[model samples]
Target chain A: MNFDFGFAIVAAVIVVSALFVVRAANLIHAVLWLGVTLLGTAALYAQLNAPFLAGVQVLTYVGGVVTLMIFGVMVTRRHDGIDVVAQTEGADRGFIFASALFVVLALVTWKSAPHVPNPAPVASSADIARALLGEYLIGFEVLSLLLLAAIVGAVVLVRRRDPEPAGEPSPAAAAVSEVNP
Target chain B: MNEFLQGGLYGGGIIVAIMSSLLFVLWTERKMAARMQSRIGPTFTDPLGFLQAPADVLKLLQKEDIIPEKADRALFNNAPLLGATVAIAGAAVVPFSATIVGADLEVGVLYLLAVGALGVLPVFAAGWGSNNKFALLGAMRAIAQSVSYEVPLVLAALVPVILAGSMKLSDIVAYQSSHHWLVVWPFFLGIPAFGLFMLAMLAESNRIPFDIPEAESELVAGITTEYTGMKFGLFYMAEYLHTVIASAVASALFLGGYDGPIAPGLWWMVLKTGLLVVAIYWLRWSLLRFRSDQLMALCWRWLVPSGVVLVVGAAVWVVFAG
Candidate 1:
């Protein structure tokens, strides 16, 4: 069997990193290692001649989404050392079985190396612009609507409500009373 | 096959260089932070502490690995892997140069955005798997910030794509080489979109002035507070790598990437990205972060509308200019 050394290394990294991601005890470390695995995938993309995809890999995935995940960690107020065990205990065995299935699939795919046609290079961003705006305009509009909803949802979710009256005047009112009195 | 592999060595070197550059930027950020606060920066490590980063990385690698007792063993391990892997994989599609691109796929931009979006999973996984309330809170906030800012970011970026008229970054660069850079275009919304894109990019990367996720004062490192040793280092690297990519993309989009009077195309691209990185880092320390509500308001009420107008304006320009 002809072994593609570079592919092997990337595959190994992906597997080991995925394992680490699933097994790590610290939640933050899992996130960080996941970032590593994503980076490796970006490398693979580069090998595939998709530099723009690679850039977006970092820009959107690592840059935007990952940072958001980190932000999520804060708002949730997660305890530093607290570890939450899996809610479903048997999930591990299922994951193992899935991994085996995935491995078999991957091997088959690699061996077949399906004859994909080389894509014709376009002139500029105009092509994508035309596509997104012309043919995909409805999708684009829907995405905009989704964004608007997200904005409204976030604002509504985070706004603080006035608490029920505590015994001796609320904090704001008490402060005002003290200042005026 | 051997020839293809041999050809890939150069590609690997480029990746290594890019990664090393990011590591250098991380060190610069720390030193810059210290300098901004009127503190003596790393001066003890190696010849003026230049080797401090390498030393720090080595130390992290050597540190003992710890697992939280209550953590979901699988997801905990998966989080960092997810984070770093997505970062590196996203880096692949960035066209550093015409000849030196990682990938040249047709849907390069879309693939990039999609793959990059995966970054959120690992982050959420970290908090959810750890069963840590603080981590969970941080992860949620990060998600909120990201999702909100992403719209404006994507919309702002679309201006350049509209102007250049392609999703492939190589095509964009080539267009820039042929025509005057998009910045030179006299559309009314040109500069505003650029500004919005840059600001959104900064927030997207979680740079200072937008680093609410890791607000030291409130969250005590937030999502990453529990992480240590190499685990922390990986997160750190991922962040820096994001910064690098963001800066590069911003430059590529607005600053007429690789188009210049003197230097070679690749060098010019690097220079532009480097300068933008410096600016981003400078702003991180110079400005205070906005409150979450204020930040969200800025994105939705102001940035999104402005970005939409800019995109529409670009479309108008395209119709007229053509």
Candidate 2:
């Protein structure tokens, strides 16, 4: 198959999924649509001869990030039913803003597209690894430290503030006592 | 054009082989479980109940399909197919022998890890689409469990990649053949990494001790609570396929995949994978399931830290020993 044809298909899928991600009424559906868009972007990465980036895209973005988003959606949802509609207002203004941004992006792309190279050879994982560990070692270490700090912050934010007293009756026990009384 | 056809044929052959072998594996799992429990498993189906797997599949295929009224029709319909497809896709880069692989991408190990991770999406889709509380809970557990275990899984797999100096599965295997199998290398680090890999694999595939997602006693089949007929069959097939793929990857990474004494070939790979599969099944029948809190603690508290240490240890070993 022609690479252009494959790229076109992947691009189309990515664009459609991106649209659906914003357009889907249900929160879960929007998350799923975002997943498709991310996966399609990963496909684009693979087509661009960056398989390692593609894998990381799928691994971290689709798997870890999206799963976390879905878990958050599931947990924070107020309604018990899965059909809860996500409130999405102010579409006209959003659309106007999006269109202006798209226009700017398109203009920038059209102006700078001529400078981009064609058919670049894929950078294998080894080369990327070597560059990260050797040439960009400090930057890589710093980025990891940043991520570690973020994780620590997240854990601290979510952790229970204080342990309940062992002698104190739990909520369930209290509720049962009230009901029985 | 010729390459495309060759690739198609190779992939098709691998899928068929996997499906057929899945039947036998399912039967073997049942028989093994039954033997462990001291019961006559599926004796009425065929000779020694060997045909039970096909029979079960046929029954599932013939059953009337059911879709709940509240379910998201499109996603509910598509989820099973997605699960099975992604599960089978992980096998693409695994080399059965020197010449046998569906696709030998430069980042084969990453490809395997990536594809394995995709199994979570369909499962989440199924759970949400089902519009059932139990299914949603199950899906939530599955996503949490799989995503958490993936950390250690990738880390353990990376030990082999670092030692081999390549992300290619074939290269890792070849590295093992030249050196010692990774499960025996560096004595301390290799064994720990291998054990960690096995634990992560079990958790990733939702096997026993990590199967809180599908605990039948509590969740009633978990995310598959609303599925019926062949849709349910697809989920079953996906689970088994995921197990097999995990075993194949473990074998490739640590057990000297397709490498053995006297002209190593496909059989060695199969034998190693088979042994892992049996071990998984044996553990399934023997071990008790973990509570959700315990499972998460194990992953975050134990496996994750140990995996980091193992990776650092492997890198140090490579620097010193290589």
Candidate 3:
């Protein structure tokens, strides 16, 4: 198969999945569709000769981020009903805002370069590592620090202030006490 | 076109090999577990139940396919196939020998890790699509467990990549062959990273001590609770296939891959992988499962930090020694 043909197919899949991600009535389906979109983007990265980036994209975005999103959807959903349809609101304003953003994006792309473009040289993983650890060492360190801060913040937010006493009734036990008392 | 055809043939051969090997792995795991538990495992079918895997597959194939009434039909049906595909794909970049890889990509290690990461999605799909609360809970636990461990897994895998100065599996193995197997080289860092990698592998494959996702006593087979027949068989196959892939990757990275004293070749890779598989099976039968909190704690509080240290240590060693 021709490379361009493969790229075109991947692009089509991305577009279709991106549409489904927003249009799907069910939140879980939308999240799954979003995964498909991310997978297509990873394919695009592969096609562009950045296989390392492609792998990282799949690893971080599809594997980590999308899975977390699905977990969030599952946890936050009301369990009283099956297949809760996600509510859609502000269609008119949302469309107007989306269209304006698209226009701006298109204008920026058009203004930047209209001529036939040469593919960027693909950097090996080693080269990327060298660049990060050498030239961009400070940036890399800062990014790590930022991630560490975020992790610490998340842990602090979720950490319990005090441990529950051993003799204290559990939530289920408390419910029983309420019923029996 | 010639390369494509050659690749196609090799890919087909690899898939067939993986499937056949999975049968042997399942049989061995059963016999081992049975022996450990002081019970005779499968023996009636063919020579110590060697054919049990095929027999089980055939039985599943013949069973009625039942989709739950409230299930999302498309996802419910497709999840098992997707799971198997992801599981098998993790083996593609693994170098069995100098010339035996399916796709010797530049980022082979990262590719394997990425594909391995995709395994959780199909389980989540099965859980959500099944429309069963138990399945959903199982999927939730599986995803959380897998994602949490992947942090340490990637970090630990990076130790070898740092030592080798390349993300290619071939390069990593070649580095081990020239210097020493990663498990012994820079013994302090390599050993700990290997340990962490093995722990993560167990969690990643949902084996014992990390099999919370499908705790039979609690979740009634977890995500597979709603699955029936061949679909369930596919999930089982995926799990075994993943364990084998993890073993092969571990062999390549930490055990000098196909390198051996007497004429290094495919057998060396196979032998090393077999040993690791036995270790994994041994652990599965011997260990008790971890609570969810304990599992998360082990990953975050211990493995992740140790992995980071290993990576940094490897980087420093590489710079100073080289």
Question: Pick by DockQ: which candidate is best?
Answer: 3
Put down candidate 2 lDDT per residue, A1-181, tens digits, no spaces.
3457888899999999998988888888899899999999999998898989999999889988888898888777766664467777999999999999999999999999878887777677778988999999999999999999998999999888887777987777689679997
DockQ for all models, in order?
0.15, 0.71, 0.76
TM-score on alpha carbons, each prediction: 0.70, 0.93, 0.91
Ranking by DockQ: 3, 2, 1
For candidate 3, list the clashing residue pairs, or say none. none
TM-score of chain A of each: 0.66, 0.81, 0.80
**Candidate 3 ranges beyond 4 A from true positions:** A1-3, A79-84, A89-111, A114-117, A164-181
| Tens digit of per-residue lDDT, candidate 1, span B1-322 | 6977865886687679888897678678778888999986888886566788888889999988887888877777777877887777666667776677776666566665665466666677776676777777777677777777778878887887778777777777777778767677653556787788888867765667888877888877867877778888888888888778877777667777767877547888888888888888888789987877778989989999988888898888889974
- Fnat values, one per model, are 0.18, 0.73, 0.85
Interface RMSD of each: 6.7, 0.7, 0.6
Model 1: how far residue B182 lies from native, Å: 2.2
- How would the docking of model 3 be graded? medium
* Candidate number that wins on lDDT, 1 or 2: 2
Error of 2 at B249 (Å): 0.9
